[model samples]
Target: MPRVGGTKNVDVAAVIALRPDLVLANKEESSQRDVERLIEAGLPVFVSFPCTVEESLDYVETLARLLHVDAPPRPAPARRQGELRVCAPIWKDPWMTMDGRTYGSDLLSWLGADNVFSDRARRYPLAADVAGAPAADPGARDTRYPRVTAEEIRARGPALVLLPDEPYRFDETHLEEVRSWGVEAALVSGKDLFWYGVRTAGALERLDRALAPHR
Candidate 1:
């Protein structure tokens, strides 16, 4: 069910054959090329980009309205669904993250783990900047770190480290290194995390199983 190829790719063709009533997708969530091609094919496609803390909520409200499922959930809507607190390291050497308003933050919102960095002083700051440079003194080198290191990971000790598999592309080599340090880590879909909807709940659960090994 990967977005790029195989069954998921074939899904587009199948859906086209049936001439469904509507097609919904997030601008930031779907592959740019694929979405573009679908549009070129004259499909009735609707796209939106939810890229922030506020915008993400707005996305849900808007999407629900589009699908005619916006009726008030019976009394307690919050308890009906679970959420993940994804931690997307977006920096270079030291690693960093975006604000509560970025697409990465939105993805982690449903990744289901508590984000260890949520309380950090700076938003989207270098790993060394927030956690300190390994063992450096608080008043000096820690303030100017340019990359994340083993010491930082050991100290922060996030419940699960979900790195992006694209843009930065954390691979097996990175996984091997992270495992060696006693920290659990894995790569997740940048799109799925960034572009989830009610239809994607199953996909998220699948993602949870995919990362179960690292847990």
Candidate 2:
């Protein structure tokens, strides 16, 4: 069976054929229409919307209970006394970053890192538009992400720039580009920083190691 990418591209027929006992979904990762379609088909769907580290852990436990499995132990927080100012970009071309309200920012906070753009009004703000100016309505939900310019990032003067390999794959070239801004830069796993799962323990260790040099 082919794996459906997400809610927008979910294969309704395939899902129906599977005759699943329960369906797991995310409020942000899956669309309302898709969830409704599954419900209309008489399938059970559990939707999760976790915005912080603690909430995500709770979601994991909830999911485990639904599956009748033992939940993994909650990961201990990576300890650090002081904050490391960091800038993490999820996209480029127009440049986009996460702000205080996003899960990513919250995860960074848990890791003792502070997002340079955390104070922006939007959870995700465009590098070029910190004010989150109105955009032409596309009938789609406004992306929490916002666009920004490289110059704006330079002005923020982050102590470290974390380049993740997802949403937009930032590689060695991107690493160099960020370093050119006169700040230390490192490539990081986007899933490690942004994803919530049993692997959170590994993610925490990886982040601790990455930030160790900077602290």
Candidate 3:
């Protein structure tokens, strides 16, 4: 296994030099320009962007077919009886969280947790996401990750605030801060929450266990 480059800044020349059979990429993680470059170089590339747990499993099956490999059997997700109100913040500094449209939110939903901001969507002009700005038209912009405020989160009244360590690296310090908002908070693995494909089943199980006590 060789390192072509980071998600955003892939080394196109290095990848082309490898002369591999196929290049795998994620629409959200990898840069569009890089994927285009690989295609322009006559390299076969498979770009995936699954927005739900079911879709992720489908992606795994598709990838397996492309590579002539057997797709691992999907794991059974443990669903709880009652729903736990959850707000998972991916980033701070104008705090942002995933809405219902995202894979993360759907994953949580499958585990019997309700996303507090599931109906909220990101507003354009960035500043419009927070207070004191006019709302952006939902039809005109991407609205999966919405920027939120501490006050707004408090108002949503989530029973558990899940803080992931990627996209923003929320740690113990952040956990304490979130708890201060009058809610139970925990630091969970970002990869489990965001990463899809072969790990989807395990991620769901891990996250379900993490949210079990809260439920």
Candidate 4:
């Protein structure tokens, strides 16, 4: 089995000397160069890039499969995406680029919130351009833009703009700034859009109850 080191750099000399059957590593932490070095030293390695809670579940199954162990029970499908118009501005710069297997974009697509980009992985991108965050084809059939103003929040508009509290904490003052753009919006839990374990389906219930129209 592979080892989980508390630190970033590992003592490869000690690990390789043990002659383990298999090794696992995180993609972000265990760089390709590091794994390549291990392979050059004659160790078989598997890398994981689990960022969200769902990927954590998948990693468990992958580990079990590799170990010839029975997987945990299959869960019921997650709830349907709610019917609503949602404009999300949760862009991260340098493109954190959610894995296709991640949760955030999946939630948006599943909930029928009209996603903006389709760059393979269902992840939030760290977009450097503020314009990128607000961009969508004006003639696009399904997509809609939230009434927003880079100029000022008081001048902005949106039925419900979800300001996230992650990557950076968007507070009341920030909300007021966005509201100043002539849009009334709510601050949503970033984790809710991204993380889901046992509550994956239940979270949908909460979102519908909280966000959808009363009709």
Best-to-worst lDDT order: 3, 2, 1, 4
Lowest summed lDDT across 10 adjacent residues in model 2 is found at 121-130
**What tens digits encode model 4's per-residue C-alpha lDDT throughout 1-215?**
55645336777767688877787776555656768878888988878765444565677678778878897764554546444444455542222223223355566555555433333222112231223454334452222112222542222222555667774567797679657766666777766765544455555555555566521
Candidate 4 structure, TM-score to reference: 0.53
> In terms of TM-score, how similar is model 1 to the real structure?
0.48
List, residue by residue over 1-215, the lDDT tens digit for candidate 2. Answer: 56866666888778877879998888877878888988999999999877777788888898899999999887667555568999999999878888787877887887789889887533332322754455454345455666777887888878999999997999999989888778899999999888876666677778878888887
Candidate with the larger lDDT of 1 and 2: 2
The C-alpha local distance difference test score for the whole of candidate 3 amounts to 0.89
Residue-by-residue lDDT tens digits, candidate 1, 1-215: 22434423435655566665667766444656666666677777777775543455566677677778863332211211344333556544656554454544544455445555555534233433545434434542222113444565567666566766655677788777777877677777665554544424444565666655644
Model 3 alpha-carbon miss at residue 105, Å? 0.4
Q: Output the number of the lDDT-best candidate.
A: 3
For the record, the alpha-carbon RMSD of candidate 3 to the native fold, in angstroms, is 1.6
C-alpha RMSD (angstroms) for model 1? 9.8
Q: After superposition, how far is residue 136 of candidate 2 from its true place, in Å?
A: 7.9
lDDT of 1 at 121: 38
Error of 3 at 112 (Å): 0.6
Residue-by-residue lDDT tens digits, candidate 3, 142-208: 6899888999999998999999999789999998888777789999999999988888988988898
